[model samples]
Target chain A: MSAPPLLEVDHLVMNYVTEKGDVSAVEDVSFTLHQGEALGLVGESGCGKTSIAMSLLRLQAENAVFKSGEIRLNGENLLALPEDEMRRHRWKDIAMVFQGAMNAWNPVYRVGDQIREALDLHFRPRLSDAEATERISRLFEMVGLNPAMANRYPHEFSGGMRQRAVIAMALSCDPSIIIADEPTTALDVIVQDQILQELKKIQRELGMAIIYISHDIAVIAEVTDTIGIMYAGKLVELGPTVEVFARPKHPYAYLLLSSTPSVTGPRRKLAPLEGEPPNLLNPPTGCRFHPRCPFATERCSIEEPPMETIADGHRVACWNWREVPVSIAQEARP
Target chain B: MTEPLVKVDRLTKLFPVSRGMFRRPVDFIHAVDGVSFEIAPGESLGLVGESGCGKTTTGRLLVKLMEATSGQILMHDDGSMIDVAHIGSDDLRRFRRRVQMIFQDPYESMNPRRTVFDTVSEPLAVQNIGSLREREDRVAQMLQLVGLTPPNTFLFRYPHELSGGQRQRVAIARALVLDPSFVVADEPTSMLDVSIRISIMELMLELADAFDVSYLYITHDLAVARYMCDRIAVMYLGKIVELGDTEEVLSNPLHPYTRALLSAVPVPDPTYRKPPVEIKGGITKAINPPTECRFIERCPWATDVCHSTEHPPLEDKGGGHFVACHLVEKGAG
Candidate 1:
């Protein structure tokens, strides 16, 4: 409890040098993750969720450039840290699980060796191959993967197993934080669920902070302690998971919860959003969500609303979010 | 139901493996194996399954886009039944108008270069309909149907100019421009965002009711299937293992595969403590597959009788509920 929360971002504004010129990717985005908390960053594809994740660890692509912001890991300024100095903090302090990174391992190398390389490089630089192998087995065991199968090549394992291998690699350094972006995309639902459960168990036992980014609301709803809604390049809303799900203040938040298809809870079909996401390079003026918002007013098109605190734990950024009814969505297509 | 609009009987599509100069067929992958179903007029039936299952193949086969290796496809045309399987290429043109498909990826399915007007109007031109003026009117009408306001403003816009949900609307408008009676929507909302996905589904439902269109909705998302489908068919590796009322099949999935699939969906509740069953391996390879139950390798309840032979024929368990499994077969016997 004396230690700072795992990660914190204050007014993070990340930009990209695209052909269309510099465009904002994460504008005025801010959030925090406590020890052992799972924060779900939910949004459509290209909604800056990944960009914010990338900026957190300074792993952004060449075209991307951090405009202005403070990304602090345990009260340490991640942005101002020297590249060589940052290396010391990377992986050991915080780790990342890239989107669809199950196949990230070299196909030719045995998965055991891949995990061993991480441990040898990061921690125990003087570790012998035998010692590294033992550490790899521990990491594998920690992730609920059979330690015996670590010697098999990547192709030998199933998609779910490959993802578990990746997760095992992420936990190799015993990092306090893990950023997983669409980890279960390649696997089937059953396998996805199994992997998710394994991930949850790992989070619980190790007491590490997890940042889960996904386009699927159901997955976010299940795994996350808190949820954040992003659009274009702005964090539109943020709150406790149950609070956001129970009383979504942003129209976009309501849209995400309503549109998500749920099997057991409700007897309604998902109402598809009427339009596609706006082009990020030249996102719609005013609020980025205005063009697609059913409750868009004239002011919503002309002026962007600053994210406002609606309740003790709930926040929203929309001019006409109040216009949306509190009654749960009932427009099931007849 | 006055003889289902489209009746598929024992439809099977086999893909042959080729090799040497002779290309002697050593094996066949039964993508769709003897599947039978009916789409009643103005009714929506969901074909739910995981990827690599025969759901999409079955949908394609219904449109005659892929020729079946065996079985018959019958379409009722003005009280006269015509076997679509035997229809010639020339005659199939008219059938194509009546049966159109909304592909899974709207981005890939459409010509990104073509304007929205051109995309919607292309179908009218293909069927050799009215002159340019009349076709434009029809294109405008299609845009209005999909809820794209100021149709003329959209006329000059290309597919890239539209969003995922809008492109899907344009895709739907193209399919319905010909006033098709049957539509095969294959995961139409998978690529769109959650917010957009819901609205598009509602739009499709609206089109179905207003146009009196029957739908064979192919999707892996069970919740969407349950919401829109009057009845559902659960497919696994080229077989319909369960078929029945949407609510019954989802709430009480008799087939182990169906139950597992339903359980896998992550409900929007933090306190929900349902642990998902572990599916140990990937779908089994279907190379020169056997006549026995394909799900035996993965099924939790597999026994000697389940694997010894072709397990169970599809048995109707009252109220039109149908399941093809040895457990159901033994219980009924």
Candidate 2:
């Protein structure tokens, strides 16, 4: 009952300065993950989902500015920490399994070297070559890879194995939280499921909080304890995984849920967001989702809806969260 | 059924992989080996497999871009039979008009300098369809047909001026402008988003139905293959391991390669819970290709017979479902 929560973010905002103007990529987004918990951040492309994940570790590009936010990892404020101290926390405290795992692992290095690099970067351990090799084999075993494949380069492995190698590298440090950004997006369905299962099994055994980022809501629903839907740099909906999917109060959340092909139900003819994602440089006034939202009224166009708790622990940003209409609820799924 | 639009038999293409200085004699990758298939009038055949399985190479062979090392392609047009593979350079022009290929990445394929009008009209111009004004009209119509609104506005715009979906639409417009009876779409929608992917597929299907077009849809994604194809051929390495109706292949896959591949695809389903079979090892390099099954090295169910002997020829498992596997044959032996 007294175990500390793993990772927490409060009012995180990231803006990029372009030749055009300063644009907010993520605005005032906040979520919490307890130890061993997983949070899935889902939305369409250009919805700033990746930006939020990138901001967690100050991994955003030079142009990106963190206007305001508090990111605490096990009671330590990650954002406020010095660069040298943050570098210490990066691999040893919080590690990331990047997207396009095949390309993320260095081609020049053997799979074992890649994993060992993570250990050497942070731990600076005093161990013999034999012990270091044993530790690398252990990392491989945990991620369901053969111990012999340590000698192979990234190119020698297939898409799925390369992904497992990346996971192995991420786990080498035994970090408190693992942030995987679209780790399986480039892989096929079967391989994706394989990787997801491996991730879930490891998360369960290691008891590390995982932040999963994806544009596909269905994938997010599978691994997440809680779900957050981002739209145009805004966290428009946040709730329990099942609640947000089953009964999404926000219009954007409902749209995202219905659009995905559900294995159980009929294939819903994806009603894509009505309009193009806002130009971050010239973002729409008020509720950023209003331009594409069918339920948008004069109030929505003029005044931004503050994030409000519409249900038990479920927050939504909508002027009329109770009155919003979902067309699919009444229509036959395509 | 209406004399089948196109037929390929024993099509093979071998690329000699360089093995440094003093390489062995005539070593081949077996990019495509004795692969044969047919497309009936207006039918869609989806070719599916993982990367480097040679799905794209097979598509290229169909259009005569790369001449098959050995095989015959029987193409019927105006009630005349002509061998597509042995066609002289002179006749390739006529055959080109009847078949077109939709490339995978739209961002790179289309010329950035050309306007949408010029991109779609280039093929028509090659055929010497009509004057400049006439070709422009046709290009605009094609754009409109692909659901790009205000088609006239897109005519003067360059590729950089459009979104990914729009650029792909323009690419699709170029493919269909020739009114080809046979089209090879090589992962046309892989570069697109999920929501736009279905729309593009629906658009392609509708146009095919309207124009009696047959498609050789090549992709690695099975979910999309199931949605867009009437029949599907699952490939392993360079050879087809299974071919059958899409539904049958998805629900009752026979070949171990097909079973492993289908079992691996992770469709976005929160409730989808399947114990994944640990596919051991990695893909084998297709260098100096052997006679045995290429998948035998990694397949868990592989036996000694599968490793030394060639896989049994594609056997009919009824209802036009064909599979090539020694294990399947032994089960029904």
Candidate 3:
């Protein structure tokens, strides 16, 4: 079932050196992404989902420090590469579509010219004006945007169209993987659905892996093939999206899924997870989620649980995974 | 059967867009164009739509935050109905005690310099209902009701010290301290994290029951609306398209726009595949919108009838479900 993983993240750890103390943003988290596979990392704010994405692209902030572990893209350690070599691999091998990036464009420049700049930088041999135009047009069509709208200013395009343009720019380099961080958080539901469908279609046709980082589990459930639930910088659970949604073993994962409200289901009483997320500056000794987990015991507070494989391709890091109820999926059905 | 608590009759709000040296009114944005609805005592009604669809404007109109261009906002006071839309400034101060609003962004709503006690007690002081010590007692009681435990600890803290969820609770406390009969909560939990959002919503539901209050819960998320509202009203470009029982309207959407919206919501189940959304383009500008059906530009089932005729009026379908689309026959659903 494995033809060598396309990207491997092994025991990655990162921290931010703030004035107060060292903020452990990312703990020992590991996951592998194969070619053409889609993975979703979902959690509340400050759960380190964005931190993981930044680490993969080596785009962390100036204060961030990688304490341990390795990120291997096609068997090459991205952390060990020189600055110039890593820059080459950024948009060419792994690209990113940021959250609310539709408004990130320079208002003074034409949208097409902005994309052309990316092609001029990352695309090899330098695309001529005509070639760059042709590439941008093709990319625009791939993302379901009209090629002619490229000349319009950023303010001229609607929110949905600008998002499509951003997606086109991400694919301008034809990267192997695209890391989209909350790609549709700002758009309306109808527009978000359209953009997600476009991304899924493009992923299938172009055979590129996608790592989606989002706080909305519903958005993640719709587009991802594999789901990884992050809590306090740790991957609490990792498995096929269907399996995890149907039979969540981790306490945090179970509470989160049940807490999310849905449009098409019976009106069940949502069980809200109590207590706030633990402060990362002075994190707890054992499991980060022990303070809010319903299944936490004395041992859970003292000893951190390791990721244990329970089913094929399903792993959960919980001392009492068996105690968590498995009836949410059935209860949600009409 | 029972006397309605608040009734809105054809409420409209137009913001003029002036240009040139004279600054003449060249155009107008019909932000809330002839919207109407009623909230029965203790009933929660959800106003839902995409951005720029006039949901927030309607909420603001009800609370008198913005004056309506022309309409009647009638609220029952002491067994008599009063037109709040045109209430004089003297009467407006008294009317404010009965109607309050909880804004969307907690970060911007509360004054950072003011302590929680000052914010919550300002309403009591403005009304001159209690002395300073009594105001403190009421604020403490309200904070405890909103789940900010150890109310004394939060009374003197400024807005910046509280978390997003706590700040929202304080906002809720401020809105409900006066025992308002009606509250308009505009997307109260949109800015909070998912884990914290559910708790805040549950707290609001609990407080509504304890206070015996009616709510016009304005939000963009249909799922959240279903949880917090007893009735759901779907709004398009400055008009109400559908309104009915939340489960009934969601399960059997009569209007095409409502159907498209329900389909577009991402279901949490990975096994579920939604039907393709049969709409085109995004929400259009409301400036000088055509007199014809506002949804014609994006509606998939727009016929010549939709184009030639005036904007359809909301007609009651069977069992209180109302729809405004020309194609939806009366009592269809």
Cα RMSD for candidates in order: 2.6, 3.1, 1.5
User: By descending TM-score, how would the candidates be arranged?
Assistant: 3, 1, 2
- Residues B93-125 of candidate 1: C-alpha lDDT, one tens digit per residue: 888888899999988998878899888898889
Q: Please give the C-alpha DockQ score of model 3.
A: 0.89
Poorest lDDT segment (10 consecutive residues) of candidate 1 chain A: A266-275
List, residue by residue over A1-334, the lDDT tens digit for candidate 2.
2566778788888889888898888888887788888888877677788887777777888899888988988878888988888888887778888877568777898989877767877776555678789999998898888899999988878888888988988888888889899998877665777788889999999988898998766678778888888888899999888777668889877766555543233433545554457778888998998887888899998998999987786999999777655434534423
Candidate 2 has a DockQ of: 0.32
Please provide, for model 1 over A3-63, each residue's C-alpha lDDT reduced to its tens digit, 9 standing for 90 to 100. Answer: 6677889889888998878777888898888899899998887899998888878888888
Report the C-alpha displacement of residue B190, candidate 1, in angstroms: 0.8
Candidate 3 off by > 4 Å:
A329-334
Per-candidate DockQ values are 0.64, 0.32, 0.89
Candidate 1: segments with Cα more than 4 A from true spot: A1-3, A269-312, A318-327, A330-334, B19-23, B329-333
Query: Which predicted model would earn the best TM-score?
Result: 3
Per-residue lDDT, model 2, residue A3, is 67
For candidate 3, write residues B222-333 as lDDT tens digits: 9999999999999998999999999999999999999999999999999998999999889998999999999998987899999999999988978889999999987786
